[model samples]
Target: MADQDTDPRLRWLKPLVIGLSVVFVALIMALIVGLITGVPQRRAEAAKQTAKPVPANLSPAFAEQVLNLPRNSRVADVFASGERIIVRVRLADGTERLFALHSQTLQPIGQLTIQVEK
Candidate 1:
């Protein structure tokens, strides 16, 4: 009968329409949230890019004195935070040390040592 044919079409059509509607609504919500949160993050990143870069405070001699490592120890890498400068060094005996200092004063704050197996 005509009614049976129409009923079967509607059975698949209804679920398809509902699934599409849910997907569309979820996409719109995600877009809205991204716009709301992304604006501030983008502005903060732009501000950081425009800000002046901090010069590294550690020299090999300075690091050696502050860290109390061997005289032949050398600086490997330096990392800076707003409040502290991190100096990573390789000692003459191949031990690695990390020293944190005050960014402004270059005063020692913390130290870490990592021993490498020969």
Candidate 2:
């Protein structure tokens, strides 16, 4: 029994296996706790995202006049943000431009000229 207890073959392996098992169990516990706590927070964030409304500053005229797109330009897409609104327009010249407008005043705050590489 004493010789078996002191067996060199499994001396390192026993401690290594025990240490790995402890770490694995600890990680599993942590994952379970994270899932429990993270669900509500993620749901709340999703609610906030979906509940976001289109701002009053966003409109066709605002996109045309403020963004300086041609009269024939039309809104292709709209992106809402907390501080600003992004409007993607298809212009008469067959080019695409992205306009970032201020949320309150609906003024064009920034612009991006988009081009496709051949």
Candidate 3:
């Protein structure tokens, strides 16, 4: 009643409503931009944070070559001790060589062989 169009007290209401609508739209746009930019960045940062694991079966060529041993041998059980891998190899001379392999490079740290008197 009393005709809202002619009401002088509500004169400033239209601009206030429009201003609030603009602020709401701006807040929504900011939120959308933050999500679009922040999500992938966080994901990429997380990906870079973790380290990758080495393959369990490394090629034998990476290991050290020894006397009378076959080429391209398979990497058997790798026993890790601090920074070394204890590699077991079957030599052609009918002897077992316990090769100490490096944990990082898979190289032979040392070799141990058992000898028996005939």
Candidate 4:
């Protein structure tokens, strides 16, 4: 009587164990493949994020260009955009000015004066 009851339980236990083993093996394989293939891609993306981008229209002549500023004026900051370079200057009178230049030819494109209204 005991043997008959135990046999039914054992029959389902074998198949359940086999199914769980197969699932575990599949999970381990997937983890291994992901580690091997995904790590390089993640590293490459990180490198790209850290690297500085060079503008497409940048020219060698930009190094030789001279930008004249006003008397008693000092450069505050400089920034390079897609096709333009922006220069921020602080004047002797405490006024701020922005100069935009073409990136390729280093030609003056525009100027903006920042004044506060009293």
- For all candidates, the clash counts are 0, 0, 0, 0
Model 1 alpha-carbon drift over 4 Å, by segment: 1-69
Better by lDDT, candidate 4 or 3: 4
Give the residue spans of candidate 4 off by over 4 A.
Answer: 1-58
Q: RMSD per prediction, one decimal? A: 7.7, 7.4, 11.4, 5.9
How much lDDT does each candidate structure score?
0.82, 0.82, 0.70, 0.89
Query: Cα deviation in Å at residue 25, candidate 2?
Result: 33
For 7-113, candidate 1 gives per-residue lDDT tens digits of 66477886789999999999999999999999999999999998866567643354444446668999999999887899999988889999998775677898999
A best-first ranking of the candidates according to their TM-score comes to 4, 1, 2, 3
Off-target runs (Cα >4 Å) in candidate 2 are: 1-67
Residue 1 alpha-carbon offset, candidate 2, angstroms: 53
Q: 1-118 in candidate 2: lDDT tens per residue? A: 8647786886788779999999999999999999999999999999998886666755445535535576898999999898789999988777898999877567779898787776
Better of 1 and 2 by TM-score: 1
True-vs-predicted CA distance for residue 37, candidate 3, Å: 2.0
Candidate 3 Cα errors over 4 Å, as ranges: 1-4, 50-118
- TM accuracy, model 2: 0.41
